[model samples]
Target: MQNSFVKVPLWLFERVVGFLLALPIPIYSSAVYGLVTNMRGLPHMLGMYIRGLYYRQKLGLMEPNVFIDQGVFFAYPQGVELKEFSYIDKNVLVMSKTAKVGRRVHIAPRVFISGGGDFEIENYACIATNSNIITSTEVLKDGARCSGPMVSADQRRVFRGKVLIKKDAFIGANATLLPGVTIETGAVVGAGVTAAKSTEPWGVYVGERAQRVGTRDSVLCPDN
Candidate 1:
């Protein structure tokens, strides 16, 4: 049987008291009166305070100076370990159970990072605008087809994989990184390139198959 006389924590009791005290008073003469107008801002303000002050401060995972822009949405199991001078830009969606972001990592606007496992961003890694870093595969829409024709008329070919943008790797704007693809360290993926495979480290990748178009100075290393 469940305990009937369960004791509530002091902090929780204090929060309840504070919320009741902050309740708005009706001012208008109508039936709804000030209840509608005043109560509208109450939820928004409380939500902001809880997320911006209470949860963030209590969690202690992110650094003090980390900048979380307005209107940014963080989903469940959100874990962010950001080093100094790292900023999460506006309208970004960072949804991960465990996400480790290194120092000076610049994440551009409207980015989405979601996965059940860990999502890591090494130091000095830059994630460009409208880029998606997802671990799971999403089913394609009906009648959706690949750029090339299928080998069999009755069957449909689907391209799915994991996406990894390594340290010092730059993902250009509007680039779609497929599953199981690793953008090697110091490599530059050209704009609008859909990388379907692991790119050579320190090489410039462009086009549909993301072929190595230009060789960087670092590619001259013995590993190349």
Candidate 2:
């Protein structure tokens, strides 16, 4: 009876703490650290609940059922769309805008997605661990110097484009999908590959510049 009594206040205390702490979380990142990342380590499912509350308040409550594991950082939550049954695993850094993540999408741990707010992961698409999807990169001209992030856009050459991963496409581990690249439906981008262009439907790409290795039969694919 004494242990039960002790558990009640502990639970209530965490609830109150979560509620109060979430009020200070804004819609964007902070200079000192990440506001979303600061919301980490809240003790399991309660942490997901509190993180959901923060996102719901800041990002208009995108989805109630999406599971965002601890240690994940969101640089811009205002531009993200979290659909149902989506699982964003641990330590994933989402520093992109216009991140349209469709239903049942699985973004694995340590996946870094950054861009010009024009990236889309359609329904049932799975991005494996340690993959990078970047949309905007600084281009170096012969006479111009490479500058840092704090520098103004006019001072540097920047290239921004759209990245789209269509329905049922699978991105293998440690892959890098650059600007203007589209992983078409049912295509598989193999591990350690870097792509700079769009892929064909049911195509298997395996090299640095997306060299076509083989093709998968589209008839055997499944959709949930």
Candidate 3:
């Protein structure tokens, strides 16, 4: 019998590319900072342009109007797809071997969406600032440790499961969405809530354990 599994060196390549692309920032800043003062917009545009260029040059593809801010780290750009009108805010870190995002999704600042498995977010979904969506099993540091309020042995499976936020779902600020969880269409997840299980469609969820507080006809849209 022959071995059936084929091992691809994707992790090594990701690290190497990340390192090479990040190397020029320090050098460029050191050389140009002295000559340019009050140049705020230029640096941001240049960083965005460089990030876009690196994504295209290294990965061979990137959709238009996908804004990547400075210091945003991605494990595999090829596995990530941002549709039209999608905005990834500053300092956001996304790591997914396979992740698909739909159009007009607003990912706020300091958000972390990571998983080894695939995670999908439908169009018009609003993810508030500092929200965390943990998708794969590797993301959990300890599978056996379960001491916290939200901790359980089953929580370890979150990293392995696929997370789906349906269209028009609103994830409020500082919320933690665990694995295998699906936010149904028009659902509203309140701020600072940790959802360990799936939520019903068109309902308002709150609290640490994320219980259903109320029912609404439609999902609560984020403030513009």
Best by lDDT: 2
Preferred candidate (lDDT higher): 2 or 3 = 2
**Pick by TM-score: 2 or 3, better one:** 2
User: Which portions of model 1 show Cα errors greater than 4 Å?
Assistant: 1-55, 58-60, 138-162, 218-224
Candidate 1 TM-score, C-alpha based: 0.59
**Could you tell which candidate, 1 or 2, scores higher by TM-score?**
2
> How well does each candidate superpose onto the true structure, as a TM-score?
0.59, 0.79, 0.67
Give the residue spans of candidate 3 off by over 4 A: 1-44, 59-61, 138-159, 219-224
Q: In the order shown, what is each candidate's alpha-carbon RMSD? A: 11.7, 5.9, 12.0
Q: Candidate 1, residue 183: CA error in Å?
A: 1.9
Off by over 4 Å in 2: 1-21, 25-43, 219-223
Expressed as tens digits, the lDDT of each residue in 30-58 for candidate 2 is: 42135445455434576676666556555
Sort by TM-score, best first: 2, 3, 1
Worst 10 residues of 1 by lDDT: 33-42
